[model samples]
Target: MTHVVTESCINCKHTDCVEVCPVDAFHEGPNFLVIDPDVCIDCIACVAECPVAAIYVDSDVPASQRQFLALNAELARDWPVIVRKREPLPDAAHWADVTGKIDHLQHP
Candidate 1:
């Protein structure tokens, strides 16, 4: 029942959600953030903070993006929860400068 990071988040990577996650379920991915489902506790804490509206509850994910739920949980199994997202990764600026990059980068 963990929350999922939808494709909308791919390049829209504003990290506001990371700051609010109680369990630090999120970690930086190459071009996005990944949620560690095992640590997520299904808290739904990160969803509302996302400026791009890219977070989703598993059942609420758009049908086109349903696979992200599995992807989120799978990635979280082996990696540890971040516990603190004190800073955005070095790549944040690139994401900031680009407009509509998220529309182009969504995972299939």
Candidate 2:
């Protein structure tokens, strides 16, 4: 199963997880990241790297965040792959522990 990048990653946009992705399954957006389901190998390498605990196996995605599974797939189709670690958003630390960030998501 593929891993999903959930709403907790919204404003934070941490890239630590991407550095551990063996398949380069991560895609970067303006303020978020997604995992290309087709490219993920289910290695689970990136999950622990997420400081916000935003990554999850598809089957284990929380019911409230299930939409992220499909969202990751959809966004990955157009976003460019991110293969290295980078600085998070300017306000990452402030957003990391905040919940219900779906409304703050920035597409593309």
Candidate topping TM-score: 2
In angstroms, how far off is 98's CA in candidate 2? 1.2
Residues 3-105, candidate 1, lDDT per residue (tens digit)? 8887666665677888788777886655567787667788788888876677888788988777778777765665445545445546655655554454464
TM-score of each: 0.71, 0.97
Cα misplacement distance, residue 57 of candidate 2 (Å): 0.5
Q: List the pairs of residues colliding in candidate 2.
A: none
The 10-residue segment of model 2 with minimum total lDDT is: 99-108
Window of ten residues with lowest summed lDDT in model 1: 99-108
Candidate 2 lDDT over 1-108, as tens digits, reads: 889999999989899998888889999998999999999999999998999999999999999999998899999999999998899999999999999889888884
The residue-level lDDT of candidate 2 at 55 comes to 94
Off by over 4 Å in 2: none
RMSD of each: 4.1, 0.8
RMSD of 2: 0.8
lDDT of residue 66 for candidate 1: 78
Off by over 4 Å in 1: 77-108
